[model samples]
Target: MPQSYVKRILNARIYDLAVETPLEDMPLISDRTKNNVIIKREDLQPVFSFKVRGAYNCLLQLTDEQRKGGVIAASAGNHAQGLALSAKHLGVNATIVMPRTTPMIKVEAVKRRGAKVVLHGDTYDEASEHAHSLVEEKGMTYIPPYDHPDVIAGQGTVAMELLRQHSGPIDAVFIPVGGGGLCAGMAAYIKYVRPEVKVYAVEPEDAACLKLAMDRKRRAVLPQVGIFADGVAVAQIGKETYRVLKDTIDGVITCSADEMCAAIKDIFEDTRSIAEPAGALSLAGLKKYVAENGVEGQTLVTINSGANTNFDRLRYISEQTEIGEQREAIFAVTIPEEPGSYKKFCSLLGKRSITEFNYRYADNRDAHIFVGMQILPGGNDRQEIVEKLQKHGYDVVDMTDNDIAKLHIRHMVGGHAPQVENEIVYRFEFPERPGALLQFLTKLAGRWNISMFHYRNHGSAYGRVLVGMQVPSKERKQLEALLSELNYGYSDETDNPAYQYFLS
Candidate 1:
């Protein structure tokens, strides 16, 4: 399998549309990790992604009859742009089906490339179903985003370029996995040519299809997947790509969304270029591997997959980077409600940088202050700070890893209303469409009294919402049924420690 892919990759003919991206050194990353860190600059491609290489190669393999009939594909963003540009260059008509939740930046980009853009469901899977139906109805060729052999072979060209560009002794190469195309392609080529160099597949923790498939020893589907790193939010590994990857790849590494955000910041600081979450995934995994294995003086490489992120998303990414890198810690501290208590707590904190501090009076006995403080990297300082506060008689609860706290409680720190009885808190993922919030509110308006509501746009495909409703115990099941009927992802946060400490 590996040997066969090496030949196909060498002959891929993608240079007509895709440039040979550079293998550049990251001096800052290298110094920090004690490894010779390097990045494959695929973000510099014509489509600002490595997808163009595969998309164009797939098109080149199509028959003249097929090209005349045109092509169609379903993609969240990157692949849509790649195929659109490739088809435009080949003078072929292209039709792209994208999720309605896709960012406007990406939708406009596809239209700008002369492709017919159709906004369908709120997920890639639904968009894909619609694209396949169009392909059947119009008798057009359906260019898969990743599953096909030609696509895999074309993606393998990245490894071909990487090895040729840098002839050094590389310890490992990390590739981000969505439907496993890039990982399978690169792993096959690398193992065939340089078997000694390790190939690791990286995926977002919430959408680790490859890791789940490896564990099951077969293709497995996730019931749900997080779309924070929307570019790689695949629920299942592609069949063909998985076949090659299962035998060729060394291992799989999964990373959190925060870690990916941190990697985005790292790429920006080192290369002065903002990488999309999926683009920075491999770097996030590389950093995790370095920290876990404690390997020093070794050569490591990661692919910066693409830079097609919306500029507005950077604000949300920036907010999470500090926590992702373990440079900041959040806590709910109980201090005295009496005068001079706030001053005493500040004296205990000394000169540490305070990232955020929110407080509201609840009672005369004690005060719970939501605080965020800068901490040294490596994750130990956060616990050390907690112990110091505890030793000083400050009852502290670490909210650094609390999802509710990070997502909502931090913003609603002073929203304590004890008088409001039967208040149940829920966190929901609201689609980013214009009427989504209003629709959500309308569904529950007459049935229940809304006690609290909070929402913040993270500039992704969805918005995070925290809602509190007044419902009697008798109507609890009815409320649950209504939420189910609403068909939006949500979680009960009524008893969540962060909400209990701050809002309840």
Candidate 2:
């Protein structure tokens, strides 16, 4: 029988470690969306993540024998930090098995909390298997990140705070889903107490275990997952969490890497708090929701899940924010490769600030001008610029929506591979992480001969992978079908002029 989690959630002892973070109103986002945008500042928690609530509560409920043996966990990052802090608080020994490629900042954080930090394999799969081995060998109690009942109940405390703090009408609460713990917990409690207040789950499109599970109506395992948003990059939703989530969660909102960057930028501008990629997911979902649907004046809330981002990762986030927010528009312009062609194109731009311009003449007849122009904030001028350029006899292709242009070509202008035969070029968006390239190869490598491959790390929620595969004209549809089944955002660049002139 399933226990009443609402009752258990209210009874959980977490305040000893967790803080009742303030609910802040986002003025800029509210004005932009024509709605009341509020954020739950969980990033301000002691461990800089909401994981502390679950960790402390779970540890407190453990049997005396289990506590004596200490605890062990396999975490991508944030859970380990939470457990470490919880263990320190309880004066118990804790051992954390973390992914080897986890950012140095997170690894250092676990160590600072006095936990035995074990850097295992590169992915969560590898780290998980290793953690189980440690539990057996060291006689430690294995603490499941989101699967256990105690952990779920502990996380539900967030809803308790939310309902108690705010008396106004809440249209929805956006939560970031990793293993579904937070979503499951909050959704269960909120739906029980206030069914009208929808609990929306936010996830990275590349690593959306809960979304896939919901679509299938069963728990599904992801062979490959993106790690750009490291904190919530779980391969599969937890059993207990999934069981609760399948019934209670109102909707799932998926966000792209670029959109997440935009959300992070929004948070930084408003609060000067640098939330991690996963931390900024809820706002990304909120913005995505506002853009896609015609909803306004409703109050929405999203949690700043954590602030454990790496220092160097800021470069990736900062670069993509302009495009993500539509503050800058990029385009590929085709012009006559004559002496005055550049001047005429500049005139068509009409005194707009040029963020980037890369002009390379492939031949004497035509030249490809890669350019970026600053767009007015909160204004829709992308299509207007395209129409204005077309009116002036300039052929322009809006590259703002093109992943290859935004990720690779804009940064590195001419790297044309020479003389490839029967090659079909396709640009794919894969989860950005350590083994993503290898995972792509593992899926479709042996069947086709990869003629040319170019990958650019955009530091967004996803990695940009451009692969050129040699396939006969007769078998082109077969390749298309395979790619369609893969369900990744991809485009055929085989007939692109840039490829014809420079690479192919």
Instruction: Pick the TM-score winner.
Output: 1
Q: Write the per-residue lDDT of candidate 2 for residues 1-504, one digit (tens) a residue.
A: 124998889899788788999988899889988999998899999999999988889999988999999999998678899999999999999999987756666778999999998988766778889999988899999988888888988888888898888888999899999998888889989999888998889999989999999999999998777767877888899988888988898889998888899999999877889999999999999888887887899999989999988776788788889988889998888889899888888877778999998865566788777889999755569888999989988888887876567666665565444455678999888654567667667767587889877776533445677878988888889888878766666889878655553355
Model 1 regions lying over 4 Å from their true place: none
251-344: candidate 1 lDDT, tens digit per residue: 9999998899999999998999989999999999999999999999999999999998888888879989999999999999999999999889
* Model 2: residue 7 alpha-carbon error in angstroms: 1.3
What TM-score does model 2 achieve against the real structure? 0.85
* Cα lDDT over the full model 1: 0.92
